[model samples]
Target: MKNVIEDVTCAGCCCVCDHIQVTTDGQQIIDVQTTCPQGQAWFAQSRQTEKQQPLIKGIDASREAAIARAAGLIQEAQSPLLCGMGQSAVDAQRAAISLADLTGATIDSGASAATRALQQVGEANCTLGEVRSRADLIIYWNAENLRFNAHHQQSLVPPGEPVPRKIVTVGSELPGDSRGVDLSLTVSVEDEFEILWRLRALLKGVALEGTTAGELASLAALMQQSSYIVIFFGPASPDERLFHRKLEALSLLAREIQAERRCHTINVPAAGATKGAEPVLAWQTGYAAAVNFAAGYPRFSPCEYSTVKMLEQGEADLCLLIGEDPLTGLSDQAIQRLQQIPLIHVGPVPLVDLQPEVYIPTGISGIHAAGSLYRFDGTPLPLRALISTQQASEAEILNQIETLLKPVMHIC
Candidate 1:
């Protein structure tokens, strides 16, 4: 028999479109409708891997032995770090954090830079629903492809809008022509920071003596004409060393505009492993990411506790990867450093080719296991299981690991 599930949510990206319909056979997903190209690929999962058994040191082992070896490693390591919570389910991350507490391990959510920016200077945020219905003007700032949300353009800028919504873009790379963007202001990569700060000053009526001030007035004039404006920011470039400062400037600019017109700014990165990791961390640890529990209490340190920093400095003795991202976008040196460590991975097979010391394959969330996934706006949605699988879920694997370690370690 085939089951046609309704109102299914797509975990393909951070967009988290919740109005999908999925057709699943007893063993695999047959069809997924009302989703994007990425979601379709994620739902069907064309590249099928054979069922894997738990492995220890490149050698297949019993599930019991794999868990025992993993617990033993966690117990023996002096400086263990648990990274990759962004790829797991909400219920699963708690288990990972509990295990970290028991073993005095640090956890990185991969949102270290963004979390730090939010903590330093909070963002004026709005939901996708509000942006679609209420916003009269939309600004895409240093953002490309609107964070890879294929459905956002149609949903937000629907046809027959009363006022013909104005679209504005600011960045070195701006999309035009068919995107229907009305305005494009170009800023050099090196000068983006100065331009944003100058615009904020211009909005404040601060007198300026240069042509740069005149150039900024046009954007300010646009802002003054709109009743509701929302700025969508993409991830900072890897070359942007002053990312935090730029975020601060953008946030303050939104805040400044809010005094006169309702204005908001947001960051909606593409959906991936660490997509919604910040919410769980903020609620559980009082900080968003780059958290350490070595003292048996959570401590926030963006620079020190980051997974990249730990690998780069060779500070971590053991790594417990608990999500599906596989640690992509890391420097080659960091990737090479991870190869040298004792790795205990409890989720999907990593994309990179580093063999693990202990491997426990898990069913993909929203495909074989049900859980909660957060949208880009931090709205939590129900993720339904589309097929039956013998493999355990990420949450189950992490919980089992935590349960095994409780008897051996002291948990205060």
Candidate 2:
């Protein structure tokens, strides 16, 4: 018998490393490569054969019992919130969307706000192709840290010929990892806006504000000389409005440069894809609003419908956590709310503390389940399942829930 080693890729993590090679003795992955720590840990977690004991409100129950209880909670709750889907198969995402439609439920994804912010900059942005093809001046505003969420993605941005692209970094720290950047202008986060204002004044030849940091003068000189420029931006932190003001100033600078000197300028987000692209494209449309409404009609408002805020305010009684883990970066209060809720956990991670109403063990997305994912450049990559798990597949579990919902469809 020929031994067939399973090959899997990962899209759950940010690096989007698709070159994972897996060696399987039979149904188990004996080895894996070309993946990061998170990817490695994720695949290893899938090999365990321990039959997960289904639970409800901290009590162990059979799989059937757990599913029934989960379905019952959906039927009883006035509003059901479906959160996280960045790690699910396309089929499962569609199923989740269908489930939300059938029952007046709210479905939201991670990174929705940041995605929307980029959308507003559409036609005012650059694709990876454009940056590599023509850009000369690359300005990274608060995007100095390029931590690859997966593995080494450094190879993606190769050094250009004649000279590598000039990099003007405007942030607290300069990244030592990204190899090809030529110039770096490090600045304190507190004075970022002040620096932008100085740049605007210099561009218009109207200097005032008692001059700037010496490095700022050097950056202004570089910007004046460049023919084409790309400004990369990270998502706004807690003081969102302040961060946005700096970006707005940058955009204005781009416009002024283009009109005055025929220079081309574009803004791009730190992570994957440019703007008005795939996942981001889906977001700019009615997708976000359609997904967030629990009343069967679409509603749009980051403030009113944000799942993180909702959880913090104790608004949601039951939460169906899908793709990502909220415990990683959410506030302590929000995490506490997650603990308080009757969660229907349906992903790879096993909830050790809070027993989910319906616990599901699933395969690692992109690796164990084949699907389409977007690259940082809006390129669509097709994935193939590396290995299969004994636990129910995401589609199967969703089907089971839909099957159970048939009897209670008319209740709401």
Candidate 3:
């Protein structure tokens, strides 16, 4: 018998698209109805046979044994780092934070760069619904097409909307489809900060001495005429410093626009659970990301508490990676350093190249397990499982590890 599930959340990307309709047949997701390609891929990959087993030292092991081995690694290490909360559910992230506190480990998300950048530039944003229903002028600033594709564009304007929304793209590369974008301004990524600053100045009618003033003025005129403006920024650039500057400029521009009219900035993060992880970390530890719980409390240190920095400095002897694969996001240098340490991974193994000492297989959120996830706009959505799995959820695995570590923690 086939069953249909509606309003199923997709934990595929930061978008957290929750309106997916899943068709399942007795513990298997037969089909997924969603506009996002990533969401489709997430549901398709959930049923792969390779992702259904727990492994200890690359050998198949029981869940209990794998959890025990993972706990042993954490217990033996002087400094253990917990990373990769971006792919797990919010409940899993909360459990990971608790485990970090219990073990005095450092916690960081895969989207730490974007999180740090957001911290540098305070948020002046609104929900996707607000942008769709009200925004007249939409700006894609340094937006990546793969992450923010045509589906996103459709979502913003939607179908049957009579309001003629003017879409603009300001980035190094012009998006593939010019039909979706009303205006395309191609500027090098390095010059994004300057362009944004000049545009903001032009909007405020304080422009003087610039060859690009005419272009800036043209863009400013659109912003001035629009009732609601929404700027979508994708900050997944290779250059970290440049990304920060872009974010700062975007924030400043949003503030300037808000001074005159309604303006909202949307940060399109590259990780799946980044939107969810930030709030869980903030509510539990009083900080957003890159936190250390070694002092018996949360310590905010964006630079020092970062997973890459911790690995680079050799401060953390053991690493606990949750949900996502560590090799996927880590830099080459960070991966090399991680390979030297004792690593415990609690999720589906995306690749076996950088195999951890212990791998405890876990179900994917919103696919094989049901939980809550946060949308890009920080809105909580229900994640319904489309299939059942023998593998434990990331939260359950972390909690079990916590249970095992509590007695050892008390003895110390």
Candidate 4:
């Protein structure tokens, strides 16, 4: 017999979409509805039979033995790094942080590109609900085809809405579809800062004297006319240092716009557990990302405490990565460095090429396990399990590992 489940939260991306429907045949998920392609894939993959078992040095081992071995690695290492918390549950993130604290390890989300940008130049943002219901003038700045999902586009100018929200894109290339954007300004990536500065000046009734005056004037007119404006930008760039400067300019522009209008700037981050990890780390450690507790307390340093930086510097000899694929966002250099260390991965999927010393398979949060996930705007949403799985949740595995490490710590 098949049962229909409504309002199932999806763990696919940072959106943490909660209005999903799943059709289950008691033991397996048969269908997923009311979700995007990404969410659908996440649900489907959850039911697949290719689950991983715990391993010790490439050999199959029981859960207890695997946990013991993982604990031993942490106990023996001079310096350990715990990272990849962005794709796990909040409870799991807490456990990982606690474990790091206990073992004097450096902790990072590994998905710190966007977070680093945000930290450099603080954001003035709002909830997705605010963007959907209140925003009338939406600007997709430098985020033509990079960020935004199907749900995000739909919510920008929702169907049957009384007031029509105008969409504008400012970048080197306009986004592919015309349906999502009403206006497209072909602005060079190098000149993005100049364009934003001109807009801010125009808003202040400054005379336009340059070649880009006409374009900036037009954008300024739209902003002045709209009651509410929301600007979205993704800080994914080739040059990391340049990206931070652009983000600072963008943030300043948003603040300047707010002096006259209701403007909110949203930093569209790369999806996964990043949204979940940010708030948890901030509340617990007083910093958002790339933190080290090795000094007996939390110390924030994006450059120094970054997972990739720590690995490359050989500051950490062992890694306890939780609930994220290491290869997905890591740079080639970082990947190469990780290959030389002892890694213990706790997640559903295994790394293909560079195998970890310890691999403990776990359930995907919000699909096979119930937990809390934060949305892009930092709103916490409850996730429901659609089906049962023998594999443990990331939180469960981390907690078990933490428990096992306690005795070893006493002995050492």
TM-scores, each model vs. reference: 0.93, 0.79, 0.93, 0.92
User: Positional deviation of 119 in candidate 3, in angstroms?
Assistant: 3.8
Best by lDDT: 3
Q: What value of lDDT does candidate 1 attain over all alpha carbons?
A: 0.77
Q: Estimate the Cα RMSD of every predicted model relative to the unseen true structure.
A: 2.4, 4.4, 2.3, 2.4
Look at candidate 2 and give me any clashing residue pairs: 273-376
Query: What would the per-residue lDDT of candidate 1 be over residues 368-387, giving only the tens digit for each residue?
Result: 88899777777888877777
Q: Is candidate 3 or candidate 4 better by TM-score?
A: 3
Give the poorly placed runs of model 3, Cα more than 4 Å off. 49-51, 117-121, 146-148, 158-161, 208-211, 271-276
User: lDDT tens string, model 3, 1-412?
Assistant: 9999888877787776667789999778888898667778888877673456777878888888989999999999989999887767888999999999999999987556656667777878888888878889988777655335555655666556567678788878875867766677888876777888888777778855766666667788888889899888875565354465667777888887787789988877654334647778878887777899899888988778877788878888999888765545566678788889998888765446778888887788888778898777777888876777887789999999999999999899
lDDT of 4 by residue, 42-107 (tens): 777775524677888899999888888888888889889888866678888888888988887888
lDDT of each: 0.77, 0.60, 0.78, 0.77
Write candidate 2's Cα lDDT for 1-412 as tens digits: 2244434455644435555677776567777775366667766765553345556665677767777777888877777777665556556666676676677776665445543444354235545556666667777667544333324324335466632458666667766765555566666777777777787777777755443545666777787887777776655554343454565666667777777443443333334321222253253335532245565566655554556666777877788876535333345677788777778877766755556667766665555676665554445566676656555656566667778997788654
| Angstrom error at residue 355, model 2 | 3.6
**Better model by lDDT: candidate 1 vs candidate 3:** 3
